[model samples]
Target chain A: MSFSIDQILRGDIPRVERPPAADPSLVPVRLRVNGQDHDLQLEPRVSLLDALREFIGLTGTKKGCNQGACGACTVLVEGERVNSCLTFAIMHQGKDITTIEGLGTPDALHPLQAAFIEHDGYQCGYCTPGQICSAVAMLKEVEHGDASHVTSDLMATDVQLTDEEIRERMSGNVCRCGAYLGIVDSIRAVYEQQKGQ
Target chain B: MRAFTYTQATDASAALHAALQNPEAKYIGGGTNLVDLMREEVERPNEVIDINALPFSQIEVLPDGGVRLGALARNSHTANHPLVRQRYPVLAQAMLSAASPQLRNLATNAGNLLQRTRCYYFYDTTAPCNKRQPGSGCAAIHGVNRIHAILGTSEQCIATHPSDMAVALAALEAVVQVQGANGTRRIAMEEFHRLPGDHPEQDTTLGRDELITSIDLPALPSTANSLYFKVRERPSFAFALVSVAAVLELEGEQIKNVRLALGGVAHKPWRARTAEEALLGKPATAENFRQAAEAELQTAIAYEHNAFKIELAKRTIVRALLTLAERQLLA
Candidate 1:
């Protein structure tokens, strides 16, 4: 009745039969996560966050304030960041979902992850995955010339990642440890390193 | 969350047909607010229809220069669209000021317009909220109501609309395109959202079967010189206490045209027509802006916990207009 995350990632599980729309039974959901395909039979209301943790067994994405108030469940969908808790698993069938576990492993950490350890970006570390995941997409957003609430020049194609800009962009993730100074430093470090490259 | 059936509609007609077949079916796009409400048992639909497959996610520019935002377009995409950022910067600013980046990435433009209030009483099922259950009585009227509405409030509900993008859309005088079994039609932005009068349960004028297709922003050169000012409990990631969206056009030293809308102060976006009229043909000065703001807030009623909102709203309006005027001078 249960399968390991590795087995599921290896396509050991066959796709389940998709139930009719009128049937109130558990519907079949196909999710491609971190370049792996997962077929799960779930209720219509299962959130993407729950599906990732409970069904797919990728529990790195923390669930904080399941009502989308906090960003502990932040994940990348098609290279863009979103709160996994706020969306339904059935809704993201075709999108590419990237959770914290999908990011660089312990052996080869994502640049932000490496920078987080160097800068001590977390204390309890519950919000670290979400913060790092959010920072990963936040850098891409800025590189794509996306403006924030704090951005004064809306029409500018070039965006400068100031301290205020990073704080505003990462406001969704709440850290009880008050490790924002380190979080900002980690993101800035990676940002500067990337810019220099 | 209740057990429900799920269906992904391939087209608009199919979505409408499925909705017509199931009375308890809810069409979901983004699901940022709907899914949360469903988890809280605030919304219980027997069936959930996925409308993401429909081709209503494009951000197109009309031949007349106005922008057409597809109802299903993500908030982050719509806000960052070059047309919206260059010509409708106020809307971009308002949307960016409202939610976190993660939320903006998932939330859609039409869903933002249809989002319910952030009133504490409405969210707490234990509390009596007329908006949640009609005729249940309102708890926020006497309870903690610092975030309640100050304008267009009835005894049944004092909740304010929690949308910064809608406030900017109201100031821009956008139009909403909707389709139902009866066919397609458009509703003005000012008429799209309804005030909570005797019936607090109804949030908008949109019918249950009507599906919002797109939002059309009218081409206005004045919107180029616009600003969105939001005052929240925190620097970011909080609902607005008093937000102002101002579009100002200056003719020499006089105000040629002005559109003002106030958010976090009303059941719907409060279009400051009185203030717009007051500032029309007047000198573009800080004193005049203050007078116009006061005129707009003359009829704003406040509750016990939110009397400061009235003053805050007026000051924010004046500040927004003054900022826009200063920007015009520099330009």
Candidate 2:
């Protein structure tokens, strides 16, 4: 029973049955995160961000804005970075999900993690996990010759990772403490080290 | 977010069947925009059909030198595809100029076209929005409308479609292939998006039961000379304040053919037909570009906080054309 706009404007609120209550049934969802598989029961409404923090107890991936505006919940799904807050956990059944916790540990830090420490890439550190996760994939994107908005030549096969390129590529993650300069330095340091190796 | 049952469809037929069975079902691709909208209560579907497993993730070049972009092709994949970057650089530039890298990674070609506006009043359920709740007053028409539409606006709605990719497609004259309950149909890029007339709620002419299969781009030899220029509050990761996607072909110093489309200016991608017509055979000069831009924006009606956009649009249009003309000359 659909009512037209004219009918609604005329104060004729269409008589329709109220939508059914939220489905409380917990659906079984299997997720592989940080090289581990976990089977759990979760509602379809649970986002990957919530599933990681609440159910799996992996709080490294922060949730700044759950509406996809902030990249605080960034995670690598199948090696491609995406905002975990914007996708449902139930949808990621067979994909390999990598969060900040999966990158490296404190003793054996990832090169980018060590570089971030060496360059002082954080102040408040609230957005660090997402920043590191984003950088992990962003470096891979550069290696694969992905173009950004600042990429002058689209046909060029080689991409020069300039400071401008890094800034443009990493624009998704925002640090409220304004650690952009240090973040740039850390990413560049890692990039140069990798090139040297 | 409202609880909804989720089901994965391995095939298009199963997806359509699921959608047909539930009148309140919505197909999900990447779930970038739809998930956020659902969380905000702007969109509430009782059933969510995951079409990610469907075989629509290919980006192939046709024999006619054109391109066919699968509906489920991720924005990043499409932008980085060799054919798209080499043949249609403007499209790749447009896609890159849009949302941040993370969003482009998750967003699909078809979902990008169907994304709703970033209208404040529409997202804020406390306020009145005709598009959100039909017959309700449009707060954007009188309230802070710095990001609202300046042309093709109705008294009931002033929201602009927020899609950088669609603007480029409009200029390229892309075709959207759709499959519905009846059969298959093709919709031109210009006619796919609808203007806010009496019914502000309807965003597109697509039937509720219809699903987008792919988008086909016609071969344009002059596409290599095209450019997509976007101006926003920031250099990156922001919607366009005024954007121009232009393809300029020149015979010596005279303009042979041109296509201009503007984003963040109207309900749909505003194809500057009047501007293109004015520059068909004219000398590619700054004065002529400005005149054509003026002719195209003559009917634009700017509101309180957006009167500056009218002039901004004119300047952007001229700058884009001039840049393209200069590039052509250098080539």
Candidate 3:
């Protein structure tokens, strides 16, 4: 007799124990994170944020809400910014994930990193890692002619990175410290510098 | 979250088979909403079928000039698609206004259609939410329900469908393509999501084993002048308190065709057919728009803390229609 999902969820039937064949729980996930290849043995429920922090010991990516609502756990997956907490570790096997640690070093900081420091783009600095990572991807998105909510012209291939566009693009990375003005200034400085190049 | 088995489905058939064979299996694409629910133990799937590797991720123009968005197509990609931006600007605006840049990158088209309600009581397991647990009773009936539904609500539940994309799709009359163990089928956009009647547990008309393959957007010239206007607490990355997706086709100063839908006011992306029926063949004036909004919201039943939504939705509808009308005149 077939059982409904509700019945199985309520534990009405015996839990299925895998035979000597395949154990689907312990998945083997290989990811290139921060220019480092990591072979991880994780469950399907293990989020990418947990894998980075607990398994790989990259604690720089802060876990703010552990949900997509707050972008505190933002990271770059295949050069596209995403919420690490919402994605499974096994789902990102072949993709390149760049975290805060992979961004830059103390000796030579990324332009955005330097700008953030110069403009004091943070206060408590708890959400700084996610903010920087998101901004890096945001800048790339704008450079690639991606449009935001404030984009008036959809036909224009070259999206002008106005202050409103930057704010709209960077809206995902929340700075609870009320450092929005500084963050905007920091992003603008780096954007202008990059344009000069 | 509870420990669960996982298998990556490389194709749509495999995904459907896995979900059909396994009683507590769920197909995950993006996992923005499901992951959050899993964390709260609201969803306890014994097995997860990863459908990200499936071939359903392309935005193709149909032979009939319609746009077919693959189920796995990410929201950001779909929103920025040239065809979508030009032909369905309302959809692009809705997608861009939803969630955040990060979420839009990960969230898929079909996943957005199946997103659950954002009711605080539903997420909190300790609270009695009929949507989460049938017959558990609805705590949001008297609890802090400022964000709860104001229309299509029942005595059992008062939860709102929180998807700006779905609201626009509702207005566009998009079709959902699905495949199940029984075979493939297409569901109308308005019929895909169900009202919160007696069975509050059932969100969509999709069967447990059915896999959403793609969403088909039929070519409609009038939809080009449509708009999706959202009023939320925050400017970005916030769920709507009241939003309207309105499309209008004008014959000089008269409304020839119209489609109106409301978000943050119902169990589903409510297609405001009453409003559309009221405005059709009428003058495209502010007074006419106001009257149509009132007609749609006539039967609205709001809770204690959510009575403001009734008025908010009405004003949003009028504002959205006016904005579309003004743009049409400018064009």
Candidate 4:
């Protein structure tokens, strides 16, 4: 707890700059993408959403607010959805990440993706990917018995998602195209399919 | 924002050591609150100590029939935890009623409690806010008094803590576990937040080097029934204008016990302790609840824009109490 001013002022420490953090061409950063290992070099302040789209070549995620206000930049990090835009690219090192591109493709669509296509869940398709990803995660959340604002019985042990549940759970995502009717229908369709309806 | 050095703490002790070494460092968990503050230029730390990966992510059952919540535990995970849902239903409700699914998933338990006020002036750097810049003067005092405090207001600051979960914890007598250079200490939930007084810049009584490790909540009586009610302009995902968390233990048709706490109207969650004194051993009637609600709000001094919160909170408390009283009959 004590230090001598004379010794501190001596300051015989070496100012050695050892090695570089990343390659000169690209900044080194680690990210777990689609259950796979991803190490990339990018700018220090790049957003997770933008880094995913530009550097990782995954464009399924859309950019709406760039801020945390909208859910357009939502993605699953360790099975939980978060706004990628609000997060830094470097923060997600070694964490399991699942994006909409990882959900499915045109050849083999995820259930939520297929449900959206079948239910005509989108118009102009701006918010569709984000909506599909959110629904996919939401169904899993409900299946795990997570409660929502409208989930009446917190004590039920087995929570059932009513329409109100779906609405409240998905309030973060805004469909500026007024495509919410179809979006809700698509989520309902997927829910019914998962329920064996 | 200028690039700051990144430091990741391997464990709790390491985190404490790092924090002690760098007094200008701030802990980063989920980056939900810190990132926005950085974006708004409200806070610019010289170093960010990433404590999200610390091994304190588990929610454990204390030996005394209580719960020990990890600091890094996200809001959604804690809200959905089995013990939280069963034993602390009000906490679950309050957590679920916070930000949307995405935000709740990323928001950590410690970050949520340590979050700064959402006052417009604090975020807008140009506006004068004593909390944001000490002695700058509070523009929010008269500029836009809406969404400000009523219970613990001072001329220097009028901001409110924006966590419904904190409100529930305040009512339940939660204890905050923090680690500092001198070691670990427990802070009572009620005292975790400081009232706006002569020093508006000091948000918490904690020293700059202290870091929250976890929050431990003592077990309430299992027979107690609780509920949370938030009055908002819109239905879902809006901040509470006035929220009430009430717990009632009824004996037959009469109220044997009552515990009340209110949010969105104070610097911290306002515990209706004085009001609860009046409701104990009273009949389970709307009149009793109305009286109790009025008794609690008697001390509230509201501003021009937020004066409506006084009435809205009264109605919220009454309805919350009556609703629980009715549910007690069925249980």
Best by TM-score: 2
| Model 3 lDDT tens row, B75-145 | 99999998888889889999999999999999999999999998877876767888999999998898777
Candidate 1 is scored at a TM of: 0.95
Estimate, for each residue in B122-176, the C-alpha lDDT of model 2 and write its tens digit: 8766678999999989988888788889999999999999999999999999999
TM-scores of all models?
0.95, 0.95, 0.94, 0.92
Worst lDDT 10-window in candidate 3 chain A: A13-22
lDDT by residue (B65-90, candidate 1, tens digit) is 88999999999999999999989989
* C-alpha local distance difference test of each model: 0.90, 0.91, 0.88, 0.83
| For model 4 chain B, the run of ten residues with the poorest summed lDDT | B1-10
In model 2, which runs have C-alpha deviations exceeding 4 angstroms? Answer: A1-23, B222-224
The order by descending TM-score is: 2, 1, 3, 4
lDDT agreement of model 1 with the native: 0.90
**For model 1, how does the per-residue alpha-carbon lDDT over A1-197 read when each residue is reduced to its tens digit?**
34444653353543232333454578899999999999999887778999999999999999888878779999999999999999989888888999988999999899999999999999999999999999999999999999999998998989999999999999999998999999999999999999999
Tens-digit lDDT string for candidate 4 (A21-105): 3533345888989987778976555678988998898888998766676788889887778889878787888888899989997
The true-versus-predicted C-alpha distance at residue B60 of model 1, in Å, is 1.1
RMSD of 2: 5.5
TM-score for chain A as predicted in candidate 3: 0.86
Ranking by lDDT: 2, 1, 3, 4
Query: For residues B1-331, could you state the per-residue lDDT of candidate 4 as single tens digits?
Result: 4355677788878887887887777788888888767655688776778887788789999999999999899999999898998998899999999888998998999888888888877876757899999999998787666788888789898898888999898888899998887888999988898888978788777777687889998988888999888878788877888999888899998888788888898777788897899888989899988898888889889787889988998899999988999899988
Runs of candidate 1 exceeding 4 Å displacement: A1-24, B222-224
